[model samples]
Target: MDWNCKNYHTLDFELKKYFGEKAIKLSINGGFTCPNRDGSINTCGCIFCSEKGSGDFAGNVDNSINNQINEQIKFLSNKWKSNTYIAYFQSFTNTYDSVINLEKKYTQALNCPNIKGLAIATRPDCINENIAKLLSSYNDRTYLWVELGLQTIHKNSSDFIRRGYDLDVFNNAISMLKKYNIRVVVHLILGLPNESNHDILESVQYVCTKGIWGIKLHLLHVLKNTDLANYYYENNMKLYTQEEYINLVCDCIEIMPQDVVIHRLTGDGKRSELIAPEWSLHKLKVLSAIDIELRKRNSYQGLKFNQEQK
Candidate 1:
């Protein structure tokens, strides 16, 4: 795939490759909350978690699932001609509920007209055999993938972030999802606290080995009203510059297996809530710089990939 004449296999290209048209994702808030915030793990969510439970752009939780889908479709149809859409349950801990409730919440979205698939996002510890089985059954019916928040593979980093889970839990979750042949997408945050470049890439290498169908490489966004925001000022945290972040993303893209779809290369939050790396506010410029930088280096996805390396 030419991937929009870029250096990596983007989700947009992947969708076009399969559907022959654009597949816009409709972010849905299922009124779900994370265990990490529900006192199951702790009251506080991840250090960078937002008051919206990381669903800053998701549909309103006040509306019914069907209403949210319909509203998004109506809003997006005017802008995009394509009818295809993937209902992304992007809020905190989409699968934290019982298997019965998971089925109901998922079916509500999947039943919506023009909704082509489901992208359920959640933490690793929340998954089990029942959830995998349920998602696998859905996989047989539509295009689907589960996104797990494994921000970093390093335990120290994970611990520092109060991620509330271990690498072993993530490893087990992936194994379970793979056993059911469910498409899996893992989220990795670049420029985490105290992590060197090597630490970041090593985390990338580790997750790619899990047979991930897609990957979301999120640039760490420091948001207001989170522990990270306070820590940023208290500890004087330094974030990645535009140039440095683009370079790191290119490195991860090159090392990623060619088949793994790049779901996201950057992240966005409400500008008013964002505290640093003001350059990241220019999402379009940041994205274009990535393509230009890759072209400048004459590199492409999987160019530096060594799957055999430890």
Candidate 2:
């Protein structure tokens, strides 16, 4: 797909077309905690998740939703000249609480000026019929999409990561979300412990067959204060080099369906906390490398897509 002249379909490219301009994501913390971290399921969250639940960039939870939105808008104004935003519930499990409380936080964001849409990120286990219906209602009114952190589909890798859910759970979550016509975005992390390139590609293929609206391919980062960091040092773990990651990202893009929006190929971790994959700190260079590699091979996203599986 020639999205904004890029090789793959991008969320930013699609949003630009929909909004007729740039519509940035305003990451907000909803003061929610994952079931895995609240002692209900397991006290230690997913092995790789950070102290902030992988949302180091999210707004402060102490502030009201509106205040957080306003503050972020003011802070972002200096960099982006956009007037619209998508309220992104990024911290922890956004849908873990009571439905009533969830609506309050979501409504508060939507009520704010220039909030063009909503994006909620949570684990598959947090979703149910009630949550699905709630999200569907918002989808009918405004731009909305739910992101499920199904980091890997393989049982061994999932267990090692302490994800606390199974493939069946993720399947059910997708079914419920799709039943209500709500768009779904699935997250997958590459370079997990003991996973091979083939294993990562299999997970990519598995997600593509689900007909999800979007996908986020994350480069695994071992950040400080997390179990993964300890594992890295003690075991002398091998993280992907910049070239290896760039090539692997391009490999993933080749199998992805043309219509599936790529929300992220890679992202930066909190600088001070990141322990491995130091090359990831140069985000722009990594991104450029992916594009350049794709061009060199005269290939683009979906060039090797096997649509029959879907």
Candidate 3:
């Protein structure tokens, strides 16, 4: 059962190392929106984003953090019976709001029962000194992780995707977060329209050199009601199939630093919102297929990679 590579760190095992037990990330919609999509930058968002701003499957915002935690606890406990949970503020730029608002939402989740820590996903440009200071303070009491969406290092690709930020923002955020000892997780989307496979792999290598603690891989997805959908309809977009994606994912993993946690290897497509590359709707099947192929090949993360070899 060595999937893709022997040196790779699976996300489950990585969590156990920090939590001392099984830990679940309770995905919460903290009622946040990205500045890029909020008319500040005058962009609709990344072309692949859905109308709900990628939080469509996130927990209902009508409930308070405590209520959301309590509800999820019941469902997860009865189903998986896990005792530890991490309040994951997923969807949109979680740190884009003011410090007071950030404190209110995060404190509510932190006070919830069974929650052992917090994880906030946001854009690199949205991170501020106040956000970093507030988040770093929690390290003394609980695990704190900030997940940044650094989709690519290439400026041309970033501009084409309208990510609304630059690589310098990511570098600065990572540096400041590390100075305070807060764990950093980077989200790198593979298969942007014009990037070659080598371009994607180069980004992974760059992130590793930046001292990231974890990484998540997502195959480029074209969802309904997105600018990407327009491109698809116009025959201007290219997407990766399950087989193509799995191979590239394995290759990326093989080149990743041995200790960087692999948070995800596939994207969970929102069925109602997805438009093209329909195979993504079957995420489990794709992941399992990746695992099977990796084992058969006796390959592992970092197996074919060496920085000097690059």
Candidate 4:
């Protein structure tokens, strides 16, 4: 049977191939803090980041890890009805802590019922040999993936966003994780403050050079109370329309390797917090548009991928 997303390597298809069934990522807030927000790197978080630390949909930080997992499972059961789960530490910098504390929290999630894998979302600068070794220890027991946020490869945009770390940090983190044979997923955002379409594709090209497992493509949406919101009103920043975003995403997929899983095509921003690009709140509508555009162009993922460039 032909898959719905025949062109792109969707994460759903990849998971089914490995797990032999559908698996859902249950987001858990590990009550973690980012180095940029804690004065270790900078006092202010990313300009577009929300107060929730990007864990807007994750479980309550006040809840115990076990409790959060159980409750989220029950809540999501109606939607997924799948028993297999990936414990996703989706909040702040998940690896910015002691190895002992990290192990304790990660072990608790892995031990939870129905959790077959662990996905830790973190900053590249936070990773080290000790943390890499600790995360590697889990590889023998369960499926483990490390997610790093590399919003853009452009230093200008990176500085504008106050990412707080250079591209070298991301390269080093990937090297450490690769040594342990751990899968790495990178997150990239389109329509950043000054990034052009060429810049966005350049970022995708850069990812191909890095041996990573997956990529999440996000649209830059302005949210209330964040620096981005203020920047938008004050500077009249441009936001991508739904049609523009769909076209750009399809283009990105075409330039990427077929084996690099498309972890996400767009982000589900909390409607109440979203301030710009109102169309982003219609996630399903936007996704459908991407499919329609892909079919219209007869495009499939990696159609333009250049192995020589890698």
Candidate with the larger TM-score of 3 and 4: 4
- Rate residue 232 of model 3 by lDDT: 82
> Model 1 segments beyond 4 Å from truth?
307-310
Question: What tens digits encode model 2's per-residue C-alpha lDDT throughout 142-179?
Answer: 99999999989899999999999899999999999999
Q: Per-residue lDDT tens digits of candidate 1, residues 84-132?
A: 9999999899999989899999999999998898999999999999889
Give the poorly placed runs of model 4, Cα more than 4 Å off: 1-5
Q: How does candidate 3 score on lDDT? A: 0.84
How far is 128's C-alpha from truth in model 1 (Å)? 0.4
Instruction: Give the RMSD in angstroms, all C-alphas superposed, for model 1.
Output: 1.1
| Best-fitting candidate, scored by lDDT | 2
Candidate 1's TM-score reads: 0.98
TM-score of 2: 0.99
Model 4 deviation from native, Cα RMSD in Å: 1.2
Between which residue pairs do clashes occur in model 1?
none
Q: Answer with 1 or 4, whichever has the higher lDDT.
A: 1
Candidate 2 local lDDT, residue 64: 94
Residue 5 lDDT in candidate 1 = 90
